[model samples]
Target chain A: MTIATFPPEPPPPPSWTRYLGFSTDAKVIGIQYIVTAFFFFLIGGLLAMVIRGELITPAADLVDRSVYNGIYTMHGTIMLFLFIFPVLNGLNNLLIPTMIGAPDMAFPRLNTAAFWLVPVFGTLLIASFFVPGGPATAGWWSYPPVSIQNPLGHLINGESMWILAVALSGISSIMGAVNFVTTILRMRAPGMGFFRMPVFCWTALAAQSLQLIGLPALTGGAVMLLMDLSFGTSFYRPEGGGDPVLYQHFFWFYSHPAVYVIILPVFGIFSELFPVYSRKPLFGYVYVAVASFIIVGLGLIVWVHHFFSSGVPQWMRDLFMATTMLIAVPTGVKVFAWLGTLWGGKLRLTTPMLFCIGGLVNFVFAGITGVMLATVPIDIHVSNTYFVVGHFHYVIYGAAVMGIFAAVYHWFPKFTGRMPYEGLGKLHCLLTFVGANLNFLPMHPLGLMGMPRRVSSYDPEFAFWNVIASLGAFLLGVSIIPFLLNMLSSWIRGPRATHNPWDAIGLEWLLPSPPPEDNFGEEVPTVISRPYGYGSGEPLVEHQAEIERRLQLQEAAA
Target chain B: MTSTTPLAGSAPASPEAAHGHANHNLTGFIIFLCSESVIFLAFFSGYAILRTSALDWLPPGVEGLEWRTPLVNTAVLISSSGTMVLAEQFKAREKLWLFRGFWLLTMAMGGYFLVGQAVEWSGLAFGFSSGTFGGTFYLLTGFHGLHVATGILLMAIMLVKSFIPGNYTGGEQGVQATSLFWHFVDVIWIILFLLLYVWR
Candidate 1:
């Protein structure tokens, strides 16, 4: 292998404006995604708060029915289409190149183009509100017939814009997936094999693989709906002799696996946070890595479970029920592996660690609910109830967003070259964890008591839990105050970070905090050992000192 | 690569070096094709569903659609793929002019196929607004035509790129990647031809 004898090209001038503009550099583009997605997260969170506020008294007191529909639909769509997916991709883009010691993604310009599409199309989606019929009100799935023939569809905006936005974002995400798969597969440091790669890269790769296979189906469905809405065609209009159930088949075929698309990378994040904080090797690293692939495979077929009550034949539901339950095996392996990784270890309950542990507890709760829901009878019992809502919030908000916080906090030092305020960070973690359980836990009993989801108003009998959930929603909204301040204040004038403040041994920690342009500075680092080789004294077998020595000499010569 | 081999030290290296510039592009391009195929399959699946569930495949007022044009279009597209294969073979032998010549042939044929599709589309008694049979037929072929148009654009770029001396001297990575994409477009049509034109 050739050690870079020449110095890196001088970095872009460190300025905030560079981020305001387009950059082919993955770091700049990644920060763009993180910041832009955070904006959407706030907007989506506020929409949820509005929904909760409207539900406080068990009557349609606050908003009209259609407006309520728009709020919930846009909330789900914004959070999924804008917040979770892009934020994870942003973090992955930031870390993958440096993690694997590559110069950039396989297609750097395409990466930039992908980042641009998120905001461009995201605005189109959010902009649908200002137009005639307001944004789509027929749920985030926007099932056809209603989507095809609704007043909103009859009007020139709303659901059609939503479809267009989804298609564009899907294309953007597919482009991102292509770059990620290529980068991970073909651009790893010379000695880094599939097994030797970081667990996060492995999970991110698996997630991208799922996105590759699954998202196209969603795109096709959206395009067909777009056609149905615009033209007089009947792809989904039953009156036109088009079967509306076919659209459900197409939608669930992609959206069910999309559940993994949201959480699998967080599984990677938890895997990273656990090993680092516990000062131990990740238990069953291979199993954890391979489990992600297994989940992706099972995830694709189990989609029919979402349609168990939608006139799918009994045998199909039975087969899908079997597959859905089967996914819990690989997923359970992950949870157990994390628990084992934490057992009898010298654990530091840093904010990131607290979130990971709390997220795991919530993840176990969510997984149980998931299995329960996988059973046909139980799923049929709670099909459109708040119970499914509660279950996903437990998994997604409780686990995945918690993981997002942990990652943001853990890597704040790396992203901004400053240590976030640990005290504020801990407060944010506590408020979020407590607030999430309080907010979503009541959803189960309420659903059992027959409270349907997607409603701004509820029956007066469901008042107690709805009130509690609104309080929790307020708490959850307030919880971000410290997080925002910690990040903003820390970014503006907080103390600078050491190159390896965590004393972590990943290749990313070996680079400059916030990393220099031309990551690794024109030098290609070779991996000499497995990524999680902690407690082995020298974690990275690639001699960090030797690379530093060469870099120093090159810089001096320059 | 030979130039860099001299500067390299005696270090343990895996055969992954076999993934030179050519293979890297090819691998990534193929992965893209894999995803693209899933998307096309979704549209194809939609067609299958609509066709099967239809009370009558051509419900009403959809009659007298000539199949001869699409048959010829299929032949034209299939022949273009053959020309693409020939172009690659010639490029591998460093037959730059022959490579360019055959690529032009492929692009010409692809253009002819698009024209044939447009003519067929014009002659048809249906449109995207027409019911499922007409809708899927128009949309699928329209989408495929868009891809073919993109393929022609890529072919045009390669034809122009051929003029730059020494561009392909290192390896035939760029052209091979584009040819793979063009062939994928061609392959999608063969399937589209059977589903949309034949079998009825």
Candidate 2:
């Protein structure tokens, strides 16, 4: 494969203002998404703290009952929609083009438009808090009858506002999924076949595919629900002969796959980080990549597991239980691949690696508990208990959020042209790991003891575990301090970073730190090797001399 | 830049490169349509479940929907798909006027279907709040109607762009995408018509 030896046009000077404006550059949009999502993460975290404060005692003293419902509802909604999804989209925007050797996304203007929808919907979601009836208290699922109840008797009530925000966000994500899938399918450099691409790209492909296939169901369901609530329709209103169970079918059909949509990228992060730190080729690289799609296929069918106790027939529940259990096989494949990669290798316990290991360990725990929750009998017993809460927090916070931290630390160098402070990063990881466990672990027993979820108060016996969980929740809240400080300080004045500082073997590492506006410049590199090629002397790009020339130019510029 | 690509047509810019760019756009648009189809599937499933299970499928007093108007509307929409195909064919043959003629006709047929639906709704005793049947019928058809309106809007834009000198001389990718969307809208209406009127 020939690499063009043409002189590259210099990228424009970096400026902070572009991140604040309507910059179509994927890198700028990526940072904008991450920073904006982080702001919402803080808000969601504050709501969690309020929930924790109310639960610290056996009495609902910290907030009123309705306020507690609103707080918990907003907590779930904001965490999933606002914080997790947007932050992951941010990562997708940043990593996809660079990893695949593309100049930019296939639809750059559409990418910027998708990023802008975040703040618009974010404002709408937050505005619900100021609305007359407070935020929607029907839980984030927003099931009907409860959701259709308009106690405020106003047109612009909180529930409608929540649905509007969610629908708008769904539209944004659909636009993003279309862009991501097209880019991944058509924009890879010459010689970079699908098999040769990094695991992260494969995972992003699978996740966005889930988005394209599953998100529309939720959006359509929301529209019907909106019509039922506002326009006197009965799509989900039982009083008008509309079945509420039908809404569950629509909601869980997407929301279940949506869990995979969140975790698959984190799984990609785990797959990415383990090999880099262990200084070895990724174990069963093909299997790891293929397992992602397997997860996606199984993910779509297992959505019925969420409806086990929603008056579904026994045959349906039994069938769904089997499908839900089948997901564990592919997940087990990924977990073992990470372990095998780490086996008998020169392990560098860097902060990113530490977070990856922590996240992986927690993921395994979540998987076991998930399997427990998958069984029809067990699920019915702890259907709406804190056990379900514990299981997902382990998945969402324990695995996904920790994995996000690892990615931020790992890519901080490449994105910001500076190395994150290892000291603060380790402290953040430690606090996060411990706090996450303390916060989520007690819920297992409290749930086994039959404590229900979404309640502000509990019985005296449940009070012990609740207090400990609240303490852990507070610690988890405090864990963000070191992380924010680390990011701000490192980006502002940390030691400057060199391209390929970690000696990573992806296409992104072959370019200058933060790359350029046209990520690969005019002549994108033709990848010649599989990723995670640690200790493999084979070059990743075909024309090694051209990459060396580009590096020399970068060094000279620096 | 080769001139052999069908849609690239005679252009000052490179046709070969534009062909690949246009393919990416079309592939993405098709993927988007696939997602859009799932939304219709959701509503269809909802309708099926309620029709089978609910006691008041047609409600107590209201009569079932009349088949005559929607049958005609369905014919109008299905013919619009054929016209859309002809529009693309004449564009490929470099007959710009025939392309615009068929394109505008296809849009006109779509517009007529909308008018027919409004008239049918006006005559029906059932309102949106009548029952589950009323909710599902209106939601499904109204959703499909929205797609039809969007397709017409897109076709109208393409038709306008064709009038500008040198615009469709290069053969607009928007023409192809718009026609694909129109055909998709037509197909969805066919399924929707059968489900709403003929199924019972």
Candidate 3:
């Protein structure tokens, strides 16, 4: 039988403008996520400053207690939902198909639908602030009775809206998760084996799978809470004979793994960037991959650690604490591997590298604090204090936020056809680093001093540390200026970037700086060698030829 | 191109091209039906958890609503699944009129099940807002009815498309997917019926 080979099809015309409302191009969808997430990040940051400002003096009276609660609630909500998940998934949606050498996501229409849902859900969440009783004061955790009994508005609809918005966001994540999994599983180019795939792709796959299983529990918890509040259904009402602790169990089942859901992709980002800046292959490829899977596996079991003070059984507490601490082993392996990758290699010290290095430094402190929290006696003292707040800030702002910035700087060339100002970029990184530590570091001492969280003001004895923290917050606000300047300046008139400006080895860098509507031009890649296999020194064409030959030989044998 | 060649190392098949003619529509319908399965699974889990944990719950008070009527509806839904299978068989054989007839019969049976659900709902003493039991019960069954209604709508669309010339190019695949969806709906209803009426 003669196999017919057709000529390559012409590239699709740029319908970006016309199809703006309905386009499924991963690049455009990614841009939408990046821009919208940045907006929310700014809003969330402003809320943080308000919180810090209010706490600067003992009995300062900057904002009332109710207003203070709203500030912190919105801060956590915006950071988790609006900023972290969208930014990570947005980067994945934009880059994964291109990186894996596919035309688009496995389900492109569904991908588009998922992206649109973010803004809708985000708008609803933000709009709840204007409701009669105000945004949910139940904290981001929104624990029951407090969450359920709060008068949300005239119709008590704020909590309902919160549940509905969260459910909508869950739906979006589920759809995106399904698309990422299917695309990575079935739609890879001919020779892109699972092991040969990029670390970011691996992380994306793991995170999305986590989302698929994890989200349903949250949705279940949210629905039960909504029912309890709206219709007097006793899912969590103790008066009606429902146990509130059951709500905690169901909620943490998803929420605990959700911490990994936020941080794992950030790990993926570092996995990609550390090698590029260090000019070496990732030190332990298989180890890092296995570690990510272990994190996901371990993440589900350790959620009870969040409820250590709730009087759970001692054996369960010990089990959870042990699992939580054991998680640090794999996490430690990743950190050491990253440091090893950076060792003995010529470092670039670019904007991305600065953030990557900054992330490593901060992650060390965060991990140490995490280990401290793992001990039950210590956690019981600091569970709701500034200590817990400081620890998470070190993880989220220190590790995850820095990793996100690293990604933005690394991939901005691919997204925009222009390079960000490297000098300004470095400045942003430095100020953000110093300002972040200054802002969060003192909170440890404050927490140790028995200063609780979510309070508008503090006692006079703790006023000195609060002043230092507020100063850092103000400096942190200034630090973002250079980033805004760099982004706006670069977007307007920055130097045009080459397709592969950094001599990157990935398939994404092989395309145009700003890829065409359909992603590829003439060549549809079938990979043979690993993406970052730098030591072999074989030209990419030789690898391509080898892949083709293998494919053809397999065809003949069959 | 021959079927004997085996589909190995070929240019990647477009999802649409792989399910050609009769199979294309069936695959699309089945894929959608799988998505619906996830939705119902969520509802079922919620219902089961609520039922076991109900405090001081009463058996629902509804007149003329012994387990017998839902049992009969269960049989009707199960038979509709069989008819849906036969419809796909006719479709595969290119028996257009028989395909249309069975498709309509399946939709009509689905409609009858919905009517039975309405009668069941009308007889309930407690509504969705009454308590945890009522909330879970109504939400579970209500979501299932929505799926049945959607399936009926899809079948009606297929029924109309069967008569239009040049409309049924993707042969058995589309109908196969639709049948999978219909069967899924049927199976879920059976599970719900047994759990709600007979399990206790």
Best prediction by TM-score: 2
lDDT of 2 by residue, B82-125 (tens): 98899888988989899989988998998999999889878888
lDDT of each: 0.84, 0.88, 0.78
DockQ of each: 0.38, 0.41, 0.17
What are the iRMS values of all candidates? 7.7, 7.9, 9.6
Which candidate model has the greater lDDT, 1 or 3? 1
Model 2, global lDDT: 0.88
- lDDT of the structure predicted as candidate 3: 0.78
Off by over 4 Å in 3: A1-21, A150-153, A540-558, B1-55, B59-66, B161-195
Relative to the true structure, candidate 3 reaches a TM of 0.87
Each prediction's TM-score against the native? 0.93, 0.96, 0.87
Q: Chain A: TM-score in each candidate? A: 0.96, 0.98, 0.93
What lDDT score goes with residue A445 in model 2? 99
> Which candidate number maximizes lDDT?
2
Candidate 3 lDDT over A246-343, as tens digits, reads: 67776787888888888888899999988888888888988898888899898888988888998788998899999999999999999988988888
Tell me how far candidate 2 lies from the true structure as C-alpha RMSD in angstroms: 4.3
lDDT of 1 by residue, B1-200 (tens): 11122212232232333442223667778898999999899999989988888887785787746777678778888988888999899988988889889999999999999898888878776667667877888889889999999999988987888888887854466788788888888888888878876666
Report how far residue B163 has shifted in candidate 1, in Å.
1.6
